[model samples]
Target: MVKKKFRYDVGILFISAVVLFVTGLGISQGTPQKKNPPFEIDRFIPVETCADCHSEIYEQWENSMHSLSHTDPIYNRVAKFLRQGLIDNDEIEEAESCVKCHTPVGFVSGFPTRLSDDLTKTPEIATRGIQCDYCHSATSVTKMYNNGLVLKPGHGEDDPGIKRGPRDDAQPDFHDAQYSKLHTESGICGTCHNVKHVVFGTDLETTYTEWENSPYNSPDPEKRVTCQGCHMYQRPGIPATGSTERPKNPGAATDYSDERPHIYTHYFVGANVAVPAMFGDEEKSNMARERLKNAATIDVDIDPADKKQIHVTVSNTGAGHSIPTGLGNLRQVWVEIIARDRGGKTTYEKGVLDAGSELPEDAWMFRTVLGDGKGNPVINIAKAREVLSDTRIKAGEQMRQTFDMGFVPRKGTTITARLLYRGAPQKLLKQIPGEPIEPQPVVEMAKAVRTF
Candidate 1:
């Protein structure tokens, strides 16, 4: 495509400019000045510009997870880590794939694909992340996943082109607007939410696929629940889905808009509390915690007749996909079970951390694990020989496990199942460059108590 070709030069020129700046040619006062990034630094249309007219939606999304997609510290460290220990051409391409979805603007501009580029020096628009213009300017989805949304972005503010949305009746004064049927469809969200490896051709993340096979995905037009239906419309206390009553959210979308009976909210909140907390966005972080708590349900039971075993059942009641939905390689979800006798003596325990804060061998991990050809665990998608295991509970599925006790349950024996989640595993976090992250917050999603 002509557009793809145009984007290629931007990275080269940007890199060259950085070289010039480092050598003092592009320096201004104390800061380095951008000497013309391709497509202008405003090709994506600055977030503040969109905020001028759509203040309320802008405010809602300003601190949302989507806004932090590119700037996320963990994402940056992990993505940048791919730049190291690569010799093959195919491996290099695999490393470059992260940008396609995380920074659509930079991906489109063909800059920052190298993975080694200093992101802080990139144009402001590229770092603004998955902002409004990139999503609104989408013209079509060329593929089912992996940043396949074909965009027809306007040439900056002067030629702000047609912006697409769910409403067919919208009439905006500032720019050309059109009702895009694709905007309402789950396929649009699938375009980026699903990730497939470039070389291995394996699906690393199947959030969209998981929903497609679930009961929530109905064929009937009136009954179909989309990614937007739950995620966009969710609030702090309310669950994303799986509840009997989902009250409509009603408000004016913008400052100049009239009140509507139902408007899809823009929090774009997910089950990720770590990123928001790291950025000091306490409000969003707490909302994530609430979302996680409401995402699943847990039940504990003892065999009345046998008295030698206990069962813990966890249901993926709320989510349309897997519970720990995104990037199973990074996310950790496990069940910690504790049992005690009459005098409060710890009779049985599992899911405790060892010296390095790593989960012990007996930890009941509920997530996917990648394996190399020779049966070694690997996190890099490019190096993955195959998926060895996936223990995460799928949508509408119940995962039941029975724990065996050496002795019969006493009359005062108490057992508890605490389902917990964390941002990443200790092994993966240790590989991150710079200061090591210790004592990551562990959130308890579901809890239960039983006595015999």
Candidate 2:
């Protein structure tokens, strides 16, 4: 709670400074200096500082994937393996590569630290993990070979040298206010959200690229939706509480089409509940769970007379990228179904990974497994040679699966069934496998359902 308050306080002051700078309202009368401010403008304004006056917004953000960008255990492990490869091959320095996104502030401050830097120890800096200032401070982006974010700290909001954001509320208790165009576009997010491999340049992570080619980004002018349209909206529960600036829908079509009177949310929520839970943030994990629940639909089907055939459908009603898109080799999504008879005996089961084990046998999860020239699965990132197979669910696509089983229903009764969807499947293993293992069969996506 103290962290939250401190973050908000920082956010308030930073935002005020930005607004005043951009609006040219708080410029001290003096000769224009040729050099930029001496403050470490490159450092990100940690999240906790934004929690002071914007407590609500801070809470929402603390629950988002953005807040956990550097702390996710799975990501941390994968990065370690990759970094070791870089170090052994003498390709890059140890802290230089990972700190780009994980500890932008530390990198900016010239502190050579590992991803293990405790944000709690440096509460202000920790809160800035992929934080408000880090993003808003970006002056321009040069998308060349890798995910390069050209930084001109204190550039946005007229060189405020403080926190920058999208808000229009009247808060005289804080710094000045100013509106910025960068805050409204997806380009700002593309800075870090998009990732590319330095060695192969094969585009390991390309959420922004996928969005650019998506129907949502139609350039036809008549049919198009910005990334913000889907991710941020008055979708019954996701507008920014601190922002007074509403969305301007030039093509207003409904009563809800009017300006929202506030900016979209900064939670930057996604379908990664397991990670936050692992980080000791139960509230954040729960929020991720709710967001995932609200993002899709599930259905189950089984013939009454013919109990052998069971069909399930999962629809990607939400999520702009391909379901289970990024870090495909690491991230996993699958559906588990269990059928029971009147006596509560299990008739059939699917998608169950043994406790504290790797992915279950024949689990129909969404992911991409890399392989070597020998046509075998390759787990070691350092040894990975090429792509093997990818079975991810596409946006707006419904995945269906049919299972044949022999479970007779009770006389004049139906069998009870339950279907579960999980985000990460191979989370238990501390290290990845060395050899190719038997991969699971892919069932189209599966939804939830019950029999009468």
Candidate 3:
């Protein structure tokens, strides 16, 4: 009995030591891992650094979706919810998931080293702020979706010498000029443009694929343009070098070359005018409004008889990529058609946000919703279980919807079609139903075609 008791004690001691050893290794493995100084908060290169030289590209990038990716109010609120949800459940590690995209530098630099603080608060790291350096420095992308990124900071085949981009006339003050082929490729955008559910493996978004497959991507001469073509191209009036904003273009091979040609415009403009409008940048907001107007065209077909079918055809005529490019699950783009009769009677209406959760009976919606773990519908991206459905129009893709109604417009009746870009669907706002949503500006893509 004495011998047996002694052996049992020895065994217990051995097991405890083994467990301690394993736990130590696990803790060490999870320790902060910092790779390069560029990622370091204090060592980060600011947007101002790049703007000083590449003003056009810098300005364009500053106003782009990437710049606003983190600072965006909607994104901020969603991220807060995600972080809180994980923390409330003691899933602290999982909370870092959003930092990978919204605050990439902080994640890479070990600032979030732990979840006790707002990672974006690091001044230098904040300055980097998803600027040109971070993107231009990306080595490769490991996965096509869900921010599956593989970054290598040091110089490589794709490095723009010391400074990278596509410009025969580009001059560099800080580093050697090397044009990275990757910069011009669609893959650059795919790093974030495509998204997938981490748990379900369901494709949440695929803007890259949509553009690659669409007729709009048929190359410039083919009249198919790229995302860069529309977003980066400069307006004829927005001069590259002027007394207002001096041109950053330094290298010159020809006299006919426009200053805008050398430097990509930094307007980084898009359809999300609401946020900027909220921030009181009415000028930029108006510009964004116009950009949306240029994004698509709508055609209406209606018969002036009772119980007529109204067909609305929407085409992605301007967007270089899909009309709704990123975060397809949250982006909603559709047409609101209204038909009136000579007596000032309402004949048909669609795409209006109804008080009920259901969409208008006759309106076709270009949006998606997901099912939660319980198989119930969910529009909050933070709570997505699986994608229920998606029908966002792709670039160069055309969709026609028919609405059958009892009332028919008489001669001289007015018909109006308004194209809209809602950042998030109503279902998403269901969480806080009473709160006001940042209203997405509606653009009049087309006017009346005259009644039959």
lDDT of 1 by residue, 281-376 (tens): 887888778778877888889877777878889998878889787788768888888889989988888886667878887787888887766888
Q: What is the RMSD, in Å, between candidate 2 and the native fold over all Cα?
A: 12.2
Off by over 4 Å in 3: 1-39, 82-96, 113-117, 148-161, 168-171, 216-224, 234-261, 304-307, 354-362, 373-375, 408-411, 430-438, 445-449
- Give the alpha carbon lDDT tens digit for every residue of 327-428 in model 2: 676666777777765666766777765765455768766677776447897654444545677776666567888777665555433333333344444442
TM-scores for every predicted model: 0.88, 0.68, 0.74
lDDT of 3 by residue, 1-452 (tens): 43663564366347435533543344422234332333434444566755665665554455455676656777666555555544322134434455566667666666654434664565554534466666766655544444434454433223323545666455654646567765665556666676544333345667776776776455354454555555555333332210122234443222333444344555656667666666556655666666666667788877445436677788776665666767666677767777777777866677776764434544566766677668787654545656776676666577887777555556676667667676665555545433555444445543444464
Candidate scoring better on lDDT of 2 and 3: 3
Stretches of model 2 off by over 4 angstroms after superposition? 1-55, 71-74, 81-96, 113-127, 144-146, 155-159, 162-180, 219-225, 233-260, 277-280, 303-307, 355-358, 380-385, 406-423, 426-447, 450-452
Please report how far candidate 2 places residue 363 from its true position, in Å.
1.6
Q: How does each model score on lDDT? A: 0.75, 0.52, 0.56
Displacement of the residue 187 alpha carbon in candidate 3, Å: 0.9
Best-to-worst order by lDDT is: 1, 3, 2
Clashes within 3 Å, all models in order: 1, 28, 6
